[model samples]
Target: MAGQIPMTRNGVERLKEELHQLKSQDRPNIIQAIAEARAQGDLSENAEYESAKERQGFIEGRIAEIEAKLSNVQIIDPSVLNADGKCVFGATIELEDLDEEKSFTYQIVGEDEADIKANKISISSPLARALIGKEDGDVVEVETPGGQKTYEITNVSYI
Candidate 1:
């Protein structure tokens, strides 16, 4: 497990789904597009063919990247974790900003699963790093691009 990347079960499933789509749908579509473009005209001045080839390269690169990540994934089920009251990987945490009096929730996830829109933070992020091993009611201070911010851990849930 030394080289394995820790990710939630849900994260792994999402990645697998994306990989399936890329391989089964996107790859074939790009191949078809390239073939159609090739049939249209001369290879020397074919804009469509050039664009399709570039897109095909991108799609293949992404497929390789996803496959590599999936192969090295270490899926962790948050529901089955027993980390006591400490914040750990895959733990969903509710935090209250001490200065702004605002509440925020975030799940610690692998780099590939981190999405700010979904309130998921990468485990290696500054805020997650500060929160890890901390318990509810613990105050965490993190330095960000804006400035230093303080948050009090209000709740920590495995799921």
Candidate 2:
């Protein structure tokens, strides 16, 4: 539960693409900048050299972090899931607020792929924690920043 990260196929590819870009493009560019800065002499007084070194450090850190996450990933295809209509990771769920008369839809995903604007919520989020293992037509309570609220699940889909 703690070590392995659950990620969709698309999410895995996106992270991999970011790692590749940081390594193949950003890394080379920063190295080139550092070389050029070294040619200008005095590194202690060189802003360009300092900036490039900082950027290189950031890129290298990100590369390692992404690689570690990728290595511990448990890739799951939502389309292939069979949860018997119960809400689970990778499940797209629709909920209707019983109080405010509003509807919300979200797909439960890994932390790396969570984007509220895109309707993707992290599995560890408060609402997601409440929704997991729930079924359609089930009423659930969640503690939001706006205080406690109730929602009735309208639908749950793996895709």
Q: Top model by lDDT, which number?
A: 2
Per-residue accuracy of model 2 over 54-142 as CA lDDT, tens digit each: 99999999999999999999998877878999999999999999999999999999999999999999999999999999999999999
Give the number of colliding residue pairs in candidate 1: 0
At residue 94, candidate 1 shows an lDDT of 98
Clashing residue pairs for model 2:
none
Q: Could you report the Cα RMSD, in angstroms, for every candidate shown?
A: 1.4, 1.4
Best by TM-score: 1
For candidate 1, lDDT tens digit of each residue in 44-83?
A: 8999999999999999999898888888998988778789
Error in Å for residue 75 of model 1: 0.6
Counting clashing residue pairs in each candidate, in order, gives 0, 0
In candidate 1, which residue ranges exceed 4 Å CA deviation?
A: none
Q: 21 in model 1: Cα distance from truth in Å?
A: 0.8
Task: Supply the global lDDT for candidate 1.
Answer: 0.94
